[model samples]
Target: MAWTTIIPATALHDLIGQGAPVLVLDCEFDLGDPARGRSVYRAGHIPGARYVHLDDDMSARPDGSNGRHPLPDPAALAARLRALGLHRGQQVVAYDGNGGFYAARLWWMLRWLGHEAVAVLDGGRQAWLAEGFVLESDDPAPVAEGDFTIAPALVGGVVSADEVLANIARGDLLVVDARDPARFAGAPHPLDTVSGHIPGARNRFLRDNFDATGKFKLPAELAREFAMVLGETPPDKAVMQCGSGVTACANALAMEIAGLKGAKLYPGSWSEWTSDPARPVATGQA
Candidate 1:
């Protein structure tokens, strides 16, 4: 599948060990201080891993309050992929230092542009280290650029503020907030201007989707956990959100691993949603 959350370490190790035509990308990013992720990547990262800083590379300038993390131009992204030797049919593995904050973004973006052979590293680099996988500061082996084509983006996969505004009472579609407990509970948000969430949105911190070690829980484990919350709500109808739309992708990515489908992103999230006073805000817990 194009949107797998966890790939096997043994499989990756064997492929990497034998020098396969695979590319590994390190997507370490800290939302509190974006530059901090680059510093960590510079100090030492998974050997042969190319760093993709979230601010500088992954995210474009916020397009007003309605479009945070707007998709970068496909041609520009293709150029970067070419430099990284990510061509069509090439397997790409992405990982973040903690959980999959930024890695999931790259993975989903790649799939959005029609590249299917990409996945987020399970348990992240920490798990690899714990499993005795080798680490190196040197860059990865050079790869021959394959033919990667850019298809038109499926814009329907993205939810808009207008959609939320119009469908506040629609019971068929559910909006999921993937921020921390404090932020989701509207207790003085840390990043957004307002300290509230979208009315009718459900809270599921992105952190809950992972284990204490920052690795994703087993697929079965995740399925049971989400089932308790989702009940009979098919995952496909879920729309994910968070501050500025980063961690929400983590939740969206986890759903794919759990065999649920659709679950698109509300990229503007609370940051854009609350930028204007005209939008309705829901405060406090449900």
Candidate 2:
């Protein structure tokens, strides 16, 4: 079966042991210290897991207006995935120290690229450690060339900043900001110059999707929580965003796990939304 949403550490262990064709990725990252991702990956990671850099591999260089972590060119990102040994049919298990924050970005990207076999490691590295899985410090062996290519998206793709702006006036789309409550409340954030959110967007702190154990909440629980925010809007009518579009994917992932699929992502998110001074920004509670 394709592991589309999230996979437990024990399940991943069994999959690896079965010698299935898989690409395990370590997506641990720190927004403050960019190099720390690779540093920690080199220190220790899942055996045979390759490292994926958010800034270098998953995103394009920021051009002042394209947000902090702009989505990379699809073809370029496909080529990078191929280089990382992700083939058309291979299963991808992505993990991170952060509660699937960075890992879910890769999961969403793969789904957007039409690969349905990608999953984020539930509970991340801590779960793996708790399961008594030994991490390896040695460098992983080089992988053979992969034939992965981009296909039509299997999940909701992206919604542009223009669409989001128009939605503010249209009052048709549901915009959900996945940043923390404080950040969503227009608190000063070091990552972005602007402090507010899209005029009609609602705050849904991504961390709230998790339980006390750092694992995702059960599907039924997630459904009830999102129901309070969604009201009568269908999942397809919603757009998810965060400071720079990273954590937004986590919210999107949670929605999928809640069986509330089809919510599109605002790739530029708050960063891109705030780039233009002309765009309206709303501060305080929604």
Candidate 3:
């Protein structure tokens, strides 16, 4: 539970006048343009930054019958992080502009609700405007509504669908797909409803977790790039998944910012394991 992947200009110079409860979440998302990411954060953002809205503040509206961003209710996300001021000893600093992909889903939903001083932002806002920093073209001063709480370990980072078919019929489980490499090789999953992955999954390609300036790659270089899909397996039975569990919580938050041990999402992942046509889809390679 020790993680940090920051670098929005060294976390905006560790926040100018310094305000250490340090929050800056802005998870700008699009997934086929959902109001074009709060209209690009109302045309400007980052000084005190706020805007969440991954389909209304990191998801929970999917009534087309569940699954897309379906991991919201932790007392309604601690009352939406105490009306966006967050607490329980704050220090969150999520970000997004396609580099932390929805800011690693609010830095893995604020450390799965237990709040471990979240951090992601490594190259989000495109590396904080390529490190020139200081953006905030106005729009920020709106806080002070906080008091956030919720902390039952957000149900300990969910992994359902009958616990992934009883951990793939008790082979003792190890799925881990985090999409790409042509949709895990079955290719063509521009969203889902075909194109492979799932059966004994193992592609692990969330942009190899990040580097080449999209940040986040030191934690022994992300444990030597996820030790090739986490071989020698030990990261809590490893589950993860993608295409709908949002970058598989950005590869389980870059394997807990590479101290590598937190794996367990799959929240209706691969849209409920490819909506079970009697589940079982694997194509090409893995």
How do the residues 1-286 of candidate 3 rate in per-residue lDDT, one tens digit apiece? 2235454567455664576557777778788888887778777767777788876766787754356778777678778878887767667777777878778877777777777767776777867777676667567777776786766563136777677777666756687887887877886855777788877778888887777877767777777777777687767778887877778877887777676765788767877666667777778775
lDDT of 2 by residue, 8-71 (tens): 9999999888988879999999999999999999999999999999999999999989899999
Highest-scoring model, TM-score: 2
- lDDT (tens digit, per residue) of candidate 1 on 70-189: 666778788778877777767899997777778888887787776778888888877787888877766556666657778754322877888887778776668888888788777885
User: What would the C-alpha RMSD of candidate 3 be, to one decimal place?
Assistant: 16.3
**For model 1, how big is the CA root-mean-square deviation?**
2.4
Candidate 3 pairs with clashing backbones:
none
How well does candidate 2 score on lDDT at residue 213?
A: 92
Clashing pairs in 1: 48-140
For model 1, what is the alpha-carbon lDDT of residue 12? Answer: 75
Give candidate 1 regions above 4 Å deviation.
1-3, 139-146, 152-156
Residue 33 local lDDT, model 2: 98
The better candidate by lDDT, 1 or 3, is: 1
How high is the lDDT of residue 107 in model 1?
Answer: 81
